[model samples]
Target chain A: MSVLDRLAPELITGAPLLVMQGIAKRYGPVVALEDVAATVWPGEVLGIVGESGSGKSTLLRMMNLEDTPDTGTYTLALPEVAGNLFDLDRFARRQLCARRIGIVYQNPHQGLLMGHSSSGNVAERLLVAGERRFATLRARAREALDVSEFPLNRMDDPPRLLSGGMQQRVQLAKAIALEPALLLLDEPTTGLDVSVQALVLDTLKRLQRDRAITMVIVSHDLGVIRTMADRVMVMRRGRVVEEGLVDQVFQDPQHPYTQELVHAKL
Target chain B: MPNSERGAMVPGAVVLQVEGLAKSFQMHHLGQNLHAFDHVSFTLRAGEFLLLKGPNGVGKSTLLRTIYRSYLPQAGHVWFSHGAGRTDLAHAADVDIALLRRREIGFVTQFLIARPRVAAEDIVAEPLRKAGVAAEDALEQARHWLATFGVKRDLWRAYPTSFSGGEQQKVNLARALILPPRLLLLDEPTASLDVGARAALVARLADLKAAGVAMIGVFHHPGDVAALVDRDLMLMAKEVDDVAV
Candidate 1:
């Protein structure tokens, strides 16, 4: 059964899934972000592209509640929670990050418990949420693995035993098992072999479509962004220099930096 | 990489992306600028072969040199996938470029630059020898490459300077393929070769493609290698932008 069938029918706010304003962050004297504002509507895929130091990642981390903006306010905008995510108690923010959001990193090692069985990795989230039945855990994890396109027989293998692409698939499986309202991907296909990258991206594109899941993807590769995002934001020196429909920004960028970046891509 | 332009790209680590690369030369005496190639941009994943096609003097050779850092670009960046990260070739340090040349990158041109008195075998073996392979073993490997490229064994001990045009081009190709670099840049490598030898080189390149080597090649006649090319970069002729000297 799909994991969505197991949801407890929690109330979701009619407001946009995310709302942030005047976000600013700095490391020592170096400004990492400045007055960045963004809003992501539910079920919309927003692509973030930038050079290495362009604050696109810093912005994503803030959205995931992994990093906090020093000046601006941003929140999950859940109907149940009236306060910004940072203002909540540490435990509350952690709970929201864990239950309501899913994240995939470029390296699966960062997300997967390497030594744990693939099924163990996927069930860990469900277990943490207080599910105690072994059969249910196994079943749900199996279903998630199916959606991830991972070979069902390999479910018992540890991520350490899987190929780089397969380990990434396991990460996708674990992330989606939670049925997160927001999925955050950071360079999801950056390091895989070219042939394998195509497969993983195909799987990701399919998963996103099947679930109609909201995603905010941060990738340096424009080709990666083009495949999945409807809208894109180009960031430079920690500020959003351009934002528009992906085609418009790529084909006819108003900002010169955006133009250079677009044309610079293959 | 065939359908990569349509949005789905290969899953391998990106091996090369030449970004907005442009090159031109300043004629000091004439006080005019001569543009080679401009606005050149393309990306290659490992194992992809990109054929650079253009009219004479459109700067296909210049574009290759700019990527190799033989000619400094007039504009743009060459982002080469270096290990887990990437290097902008246009701004990379000479020492770094030197190391990359010895390890990950290889270049081949139409003319063979043979040193005086160096035997054809030793010339092909030079790269492996410098990489610390035993001299005898390096030469043995060199002979294997030479044979694969259709070079006659009788020429093994002879100096390449005395070889025919086709023979020298074969020797040049053998030397470049000796190391099987991750990124190979070819500048009209088949220009000096006869039909049979050109076919030999093309067959050898097909083998390299299967071994996952990325290549950027300039060819006047791409018909023979068309089967191996993943993308064709058509460089249009550029109008010289005369600048104040």
Candidate 2:
């Protein structure tokens, strides 16, 4: 049975799947992020939009436990786990990052090592997730690549030989090969052509819908933010300036920063 | 010369032309051929921004590498025309052509980086070292380029890999453009850039074009191609389509 199935129906239906309280991060004299509080419920997509240096990336990294917050309370909805992300032990957090949470970076090159082949890239994550059978892992990787629309016949080609769009599809396949519950996408389609961007976004939407994977997408493109988000958070100067449903944020933005961002792209 | 007069190039006066271009990769596991580019062809004018666009595995990046002579084309011919001379790059000696490449072409890859932990200022200055320019002068020029892209001056001695994605892209652009070449080949130059940094790149490319420096931009973003390209050349799944923008 799935983790969700084992939880109390009341807890599964009503509680926030992930919650952050008084989250803050600092670097020397600079205040990167401060007093950020948010909640991500199951079966929901949360979008984060901000200008450069607004701490969106930093905040996302904090949430993924890639960086430690100076002060914060993070509680994830993992019944099998005993503590929050910050409270978890080293091995536990590593397990969580590798198995439950996955990151898809904007630059596809960053997601996978340049030296590894497509099959190797996919296998690395599956191996880390404790799958040891070689034949089973290879077959699972192939199936995942097929699901992501990757041309599986070129499984051994290194990333350098693949086009940027193709490499991204492979990256997506690797990220989802383990069936992670939370996927953090950092401007996933920022540099792709519009036609290619459309396809990637469509694939992501389909995967989210079919698997009910909770996502936190960080981007400066309002077009992408509008298309994928259920709820939107507008950030500025390391704080949440405004928050609302996607339609509400786009239609009646109350914050000046959000308004500026919307108009700048226009 | 008038604009119309300048637009005219003699028949077969192509500076860079490719015909029946094809390349394939022999995959290890699948044990089959992966065609990087399939029978792609295009003729580029001397000073034009020819944008190549396509979905990821469509061989757009491979086409660029093939054109630059970095990746040898398994088939077809790439002809480069220079004043009073024309040479097929496929037949040129690797070392001699590499020297030509350094002087006449500037190619920036998607995974651009400097030496292991090299300072940003030094990285930019590396290209101009043999130009007889003073070290201080080269650094000044580097700083000028960095400021144009909104990179802080205090980060000059800092390594770019330690910087953010946007910042590293700016440094990469600065390094490639510090010593202007006749042809600039950019692969997704603004991939990690913010709006501010991207605008700076657009403006710089515009200035380079105005100066009659030829550029061939391989970009995915329509906004980027619209900003810098004079024409669009697309590499579809296995076909090449050239269209004037």
Which prediction has the highest lDDT against the true structure? 1
Candidate 2 global TM-score: 0.50
Tens-place lDDT digits, model 2, residues B45-149: 655778877787787777777677655556777666653255565545333344456456678755555433458887777666544458888788888888888
Model 1 lDDT, residue A22, Cα: 95
Q: Which residue pairs in candidate 2 collide?
A: A193-B220
Off by over 4 Å in 2: A1-12, B1-245
Give the DockQ-based CAPRI class for model 1.
Answer: incorrect
Name the regions of candidate 1 deviating beyond 4 angstroms: A1-14, B1-245
lDDT of 1 by residue, B190-245 (tens): 89788777888898888778777889899878887889988777778863231111
